[model samples]
Target chain A: MKNFHLDRRQLSVPYLIYLVLFVVMPLLVVLYYGFTDDDGNISFTNFIVFFTNSKTMGTLVYSLAIAVIVTVICLLLAYPVAYILAKGKYARKHSFLMIFVLPMWINFTLRITALKEILTMLEGNLAYHPFLNTVICMVYDFLPFMIMPLFNALTKLDSSIIEAGYDLGATFPQVLKSIILPLTVPGIISGITMVFLPAMTNYVVLDMVYNSTYIMGSLIGSYFSSYDWNNGSIISAILLMFIGFFAIFTERILNRGEKEEQRI
Target chain B: MEKTKTIIKMNNVRKSFDGKINVIENLSLDINEGEFVTLLGPSGCGKTTILRMIGGFDKPTEGEILLDGSDISMLAPNERPVNTVFQKYALFPHLNVYDNIAFGLKLKQLTKAEIDRKVSEVLELVDLEGFEKRSITTLSGGQQQRIAIARAVVNEPRVLLLDESLSALDYKMRKEMQLELKSMHKRLGITFIFVTHDQEEALTMSDKIVVLADGKVQQVGTPEEIYNEPANVFVADFIGESNIFNGVMTGKMKAAFAGTEFNCVDDYETGKKIEAVIRPEDVTVVKPGEGQLNGEVTSTDFKGTFYITFVQCGQYEMEVHCLENYRPGETVGLHVLPDNIHIIPYDTSINNFEGMIDGFVDGKGLFIVFRDFSMFVDAHRLYPDSSVSRGRLIGQDGEHIDYQGKKVMASFQPEDGDMSDDAKKGDIVGNIVSFYYIGDHYSYTIRTDNEIDYVVDDEDLWNYGDKVSVILPKKKMKYRLLEEQKQEVAD
Candidate 1:
């Protein structure tokens, strides 16, 4: 029995090694560079530089604001589509879902280029507006990611629970409110995380659409391009902290939802 | 008994999933107020489909479902005055027991105090008053079922549907909950429509049992009526353990089977063919030569309350349940009381073959050729001094008879033939073409070498592709002279 147990546990060794090598090692390197100066001596100069630069601070806020908009828009568009795919009469039409998800299978850069061309053709000069263009591209690219998680959440939900809601004198809207929405909290949280983090830091999408460097992603890119390793690592570390805070916030929201669920 | 009002009525209801095959065809059932009715059938027999239609989860392709005199077939599940406790309980994992029960009341925008009182009252009804704060996941299967019941009952709809609600609980818990549900039905005084494949549950809890098979209602009656007098072979076989035999009703209180005429209680046409069902418990075991039919005990199982003894009388296997201990291979006689014998009138779909007696062995058996093929019969009763040889059976009269050419009619119950794939040296060769598990045994439709289809039953396992021989024991085969019948003038 002991040998069998050991044999089962050994299957995870490769994954453990990969986490330490790729994830822990890179985070450690970023921490190391964030605290060191040009002489490779320990110092807080890069942190001061990142906090004091008005351009970097302004870009960070602008990136956050744009990510919030993109996340909101993606959620608003994806929730209903996901619900229709997962629970509606046409739920078994996997080929219809394939239509929404087919673009994801193509090369990312090629898909963005094609989308840029279509939007350019439709709006002409108006499509070139920097913030609007960036927001549109982010929502377009991240909407599938948002839908996927929400769809998974809605699909795993026991259909009988919704029926039970209806059987107990609740109308369609009441069932959705009392059962479907609260049950899919995990999916909504994951969708927000998936779209929010990428929308905050994806400079390539903004560059391909707007042809301008205006967000923290672009700021980080310019720092790396100039070979400012110390300041670049510091900004990267702060962005990691931002994601960490957001993750905690989402966790808090999930816990609060769970608590409310129990009280109900 | 007071005249009960009909709370729900399904009129000419038909349901089909794919439009080609109907799951429920032309079904009409009336559920009385405060009565507990169970739709009992095997899987895929449309019991659940009926429940779904009544609960509004599914709509019938045709016909109307009346709820208290109004057609509610087109109404949504929420709009109907009905609720359901699903098989899996379907309690919201996110909600506590109190809230789950209070959900219906809260949806009506009831005041907080009203909802709380109703929820608490329902929780008390299910015997889980203190479980108000417990999470649904934390409860046991029985508790969850109770909570599901509480959730539905809290709505106080005109009718409540339970789709095998206690099926998930352990046997002990199921028994307990069955009694609890009966009492709850009395207390609530609302119509309850239940669906289950378990006959014991249906028999114990239902005021009315509707036995369904292949999208048709076979019998609908009280538990005692369904148990004592089954409508047909399917109902007799499906309800409980029964010793069903092919018989002919010769007169009122008289039926003939297994070469002997016996008294029965059922009154039918004198010349009508019938199938007789005698419940195992009603058959008494007497001394070898004392009772109606003599047989040897093949096996005996001591069931705590009584011994289930299997007796072989000629070609018929009769099951007898009694407290008396009997050794295997002991000679015994089965005394089936007159009233205990139930006669179901002839079903046209039974297997009746016209054949000729091909061979005969004096004091041993006879061989009958059917459908251009011959099968052995182990019966010992035949005309004495009859010129019977290979394929010919001639009576005492001096007649130039071709033994292999005489015609006869053979008939037997589906359960008579014993099937075996390795019995290659038997009297008949057949392929195990198709089979369905009819609860107790597998009912196989075997196609003989002559391309004749015969339905047979086997307790032993056999697959679809098996090449097998069906051995029809002579004592089990029932036959009469077709030529003799043709000679006689029709009435």
Candidate 2:
């Protein structure tokens, strides 16, 4: 079972246990609740109701749109910052990386609470609008998740590759484009997954700051509060499926990047 | 043929990391078109600094660097008509061999067909014709090195700088690449300035070698001139194996050492101390009595092509290379032809010899002088006038006669002795004050009963404070009286 050439059994045991405890058990419970009517007869009523509701469908669209927005913003801002931090002088990198990472140390709840307070203050006293406040909060919350991986990818890259490009007569801009940017795709993929997944799932910052925001997290929260367990279960199931599909997509992307690097 | 013209010239280049300490000081050199020059030296000798200056990667703190006789000291590395094959052979990981070679041509806005043609031509030149589409990481170290050369040369720069590019390759591969690079230089006719610390590499490939040490250029010449005729002691010692003997000029053509006088070809200014360098191969071993240098063979090492023998005469051990195998502990005679010997003046500014004096002693109750007692035993065989029957003094006779027994002082010469039985050869003994184990033999410093000093080598183990008799050969000793007479006549 523990042989070096075939350690599948050794790894499978824990994975099986985890699958039974967390995934299988919760999924079974959700399915049980989702299929049963109020009296206990099996039915497809909850899923049907979930699909028919325009409000829940609109919530999904809003959630997906916001996630895409946050992911794009994080990718853009993280790339340049990460590039500069990795290639900049030692002292400059130290100070800039410190500033970029400082917010990560704060507790998630406290950070969101702080954002909420700032948003309220900005809306009331500074006369800023809610949409800009929410965008700013989401970007601030997810930035480090994006920047950390990007920085790691950029810093670990061999400077020789860039030098080779320059020596071969590529201008500075061409080196960055052909050599540096291509080599950093893995980090970019990782940053995208890190920002998109968490932002899609996380609702506290959005709720605390953007209370009226019609997103999936708020819809799920409203269903549970109204004692609509069947509807909530269906919504949760859809969210799980969405996350599963993305997980596979991300893995595929990462693997492709790896293969490309190897080929190069 | 017209393209083969003077490409680069660096004049009085100086650089320093810290404002006060210069790493490359007042360096100047010229690189002709199509010529291969190597900067050879030990580490921290500023060879790399000069290469960097020529490559335009570094700015000279003082002086100017000219490319094709135009000042390009202030130009960036890219703007100069030069490229570098770095020690690491920095290759783009993202680019295939074809793209790596095409990168420069592409940057110049060359058309696709031209770029492809040039890249293929270079790949063929480097013997990587079929490897154009291969990834750089997939290539072996030697292949990568060739690619590096190909990439640099394909640019058709007037000059290419290689900073230890072959250092990463294994010995056989390095040798192969060296030949390849040399042939490539001949075919392309591009100026190549190589920087390496390996003497053999510089000797094998370079048209000229510039030897550097301590941020200064020691000598610049062909491999034969640098190796056969070194400019100074540093260059002599750095370039190859050399046996150096420190001595003072005794006559117009004579240098006395180890109780023997040798006629030297080069004349030194009178009274000046100088060192003589002879290649070990120049020394020939013969029967003890027949050769000018008589010494006991302390040890012999058999290196496949030659036998290296260490011989001890008096206090100094001379290294001699001979073709014949000789056993250790055998007494032999060594002879070196006068023309083969090179004498270089010792720079007294750095090495102060006065501090080497052992102690001051009263000689003949007159002049008080410091004694190098070890030197005296070595001197017995060196001073011709000192024998068993006669003695010679180093002091002025008038001073000793003036102060005799009043404020008694005296100075003694090891060469000053008599040949009488009471003080005959091998009769005057001294107590060994100290012994230094110098590899194959022990150098013993003995102080005689008359307070005179002597130095000699003993193959046999002898402890400090042991009583040892000094053996002064009669023919080897001389009286300075005749030399004094000659000096007076000449004056």
Candidate 3:
């Protein structure tokens, strides 16, 4: 039994290595930097500075607002596309799926650069505003990520279940609300994650598109680039904590969904 | 108990996939409001297509389908008053049992308490009371199947279509589920149209069986009618084990076979061709000369409860199933009583002799006449000395005729009969092409030099490519004509 336990532990070695290298080490660095002074002495002054600063507080609030905006936009764009892909009677479903997935194949930086070019063209020639350009870029960059998971969930659903709903005297609108919407929660959660997290920390797209927007990611990047290592690391640690909390929360939601699925 | 009248009527329904080829043709059926009807047939016979049409998942290309006396051929599946239990039991995998069952009710804007009550009731109906809180994926195959059933029944649709719903279950579970479904049908009193290729299940559970073949309804009746009185040869063969024989009508209500005459109740005129069918269990074996057919026992199979005997009487071979045991090489008399025999018009298009035959020369002086060949000469043999002549055979149509009414005769030497008469006029020296051991005896296929195939069965096994002479008995040879041939009686 001891040897069997050892074999099982050995089988998990690669995952353990990955967790230690990426997750644990990064978190330890963030924690260490979060409480360290300018001279590298262990202190709580850096955290105090982070919490007391009004600019940091405003950046945190701005980050949350941007995350919510990105999530709502993703949901709006993805739901109908996913529904059509799931139930469309077209003969070329695979080809349409390929078209939806094609945008994801390009490098993220390249796609953001392309979006920046399009935004610059719109502002230059079409007189498009800055805030609108930011929204467009964020939605465009993360649309495929939002669509893929939602499409998978919707397509995998049993169509007969919908028919059963109709047979039971449920109208069309009611089916969409009760059956299609609630059943796609996992995909919706995943899609929110796909859009929210990236849009929160993506300073590159904001830098190219927005002027004088002082977003949280922009503030962090500016601090790091100006060589204020202590302030930058403290801000980075704060952002890391926010992301960690939500990641764990999202993981818990997913695990609960899975358990509920198994129980049914 | 409230008894509802007929709710769904399919009138002259026809479905064709390619516009030219009909998958289901002119099918008319009615389902009583609370009765369970099963559409049973082999694969590709359009049984499921019929069910789908009734469910409104598929629309008939021609004709009308009505639900509660209202035509629903144009309605979508969701608009129809029916729910379908697909073969795969397409249950919602993402939802728990309660949510899955309550999904439909919730769609109707029902109160939460009412939805919960209905879900619980259906859960109890399928005997999965505690399963309401269980995840659908965690359930066993049988449990999941029950959940699917519960999900459909909770809505209380007017008609429930089960397309081979019990097929996915294991044997033991299938038997249990069949009983459960029957009781559920009794309790719910809803119209149920079940589709399955399993005849036994259709026989055991359904109030009516609709037998389909080649996209057409072969017969529709109660289980007893389909089992006892089949409408046609296909129905008879498909429903049970039947020994079918091809015979010609000699007189009204009388048929002759293997030198014995039997009384058959058929409405056809005298001298009409017909095919007779008798179930294996209906035939009784007796002493050789006393029964309708006399033949040697080519083979016998001992099946634990009874014996299945195969007898070769002249040109016809038949199977006789009895409780008494009989052995091979024994001469057995087979009796098919008049009540046991069912005669129908022969469809010669489907059944025809397409084989070769080979036999040894038992006697040399046997005369042979080729019924198909009218003006033919033999070059390889000598003629007989006693009035050796080639004569134009005279008949009612006259001598030297060209059509089917003509006959010809050729005489040969008796001493050279081993070579001349060994190969009869209709018989060709053929090589044994193949042989199959079908339990009792070996059935052989012989390929003649004339490119004709003959199927001949004997207890004696022959090897492939073995050359042998064959004789076609004149009395055994019968022409399959488009119309009956008039026979002249000599006075």
Which candidate has the highest lDDT of all? Answer: 1
DockQ of each: 0.40, 0.25, 0.26
Candidate 3 lDDT by residue in tens digits, B1-491:
56648798889999987565778989898787788899988887999999888777677999999888999998876777688787877777667789888866766678998998898899889998877788778888898888888878888888888989999899999999999999999999888899999988988899888999768898999898888777876677677677765567888788765456788776677777675777889889999887888888888889898888888887567788988877788897888778777877755342123211111122232223342222222211212221212443223444332223323233221112221124454345777755544323454555565544455555566687777554444333433213325555433
lDDT of 2 by residue, B375-419 (tens): 222222223332222222232322212111122112222323222
Instruction: Give the DockQ of candidate 1.
Output: 0.40
Superposition error at B173 for model 1 (Å): 0.8
Say what the interface RMSD of candidate 2 is: 3.0
- Model 1, range A1-264, lDDT digits (tens) per residue? 545455656988999999999999999999999899988999998888777888888888899999999999999999999988998776355777778888898988998888888888888863358788888888888888999989988887879889988888788888888899989998899999999998999999988886575787788778789998888899999999998999999999878766644543
Q: Please give the range of 10 consecutive residues that has the lowest summed lDDT in model 1 chain A.
A: A255-264
Model 2, runs deviating above 4 Å: A1-16, A27-61, A89-99, A112-127, A229-264, B1-6, B17-21, B251-262, B348-491
Clashing pairs in 1: B355-B408, B358-B391, B377-B474, B378-B474, B378-B475, B379-B474, B391-B403, B391-B404, B392-B403, B392-B404
Give the worst 10-residue stretch by lDDT in candidate 3 chain B: B412-421
lDDT of 1 by residue, B292-365 (tens): 99998999999999999988888677888999999998998889889898988867565577876766655455
How does the DockQ of candidate 3 come out?
A: 0.26
Docking class of 1: acceptable
What's the candidate order when arranged by decreasing DockQ?
1, 3, 2
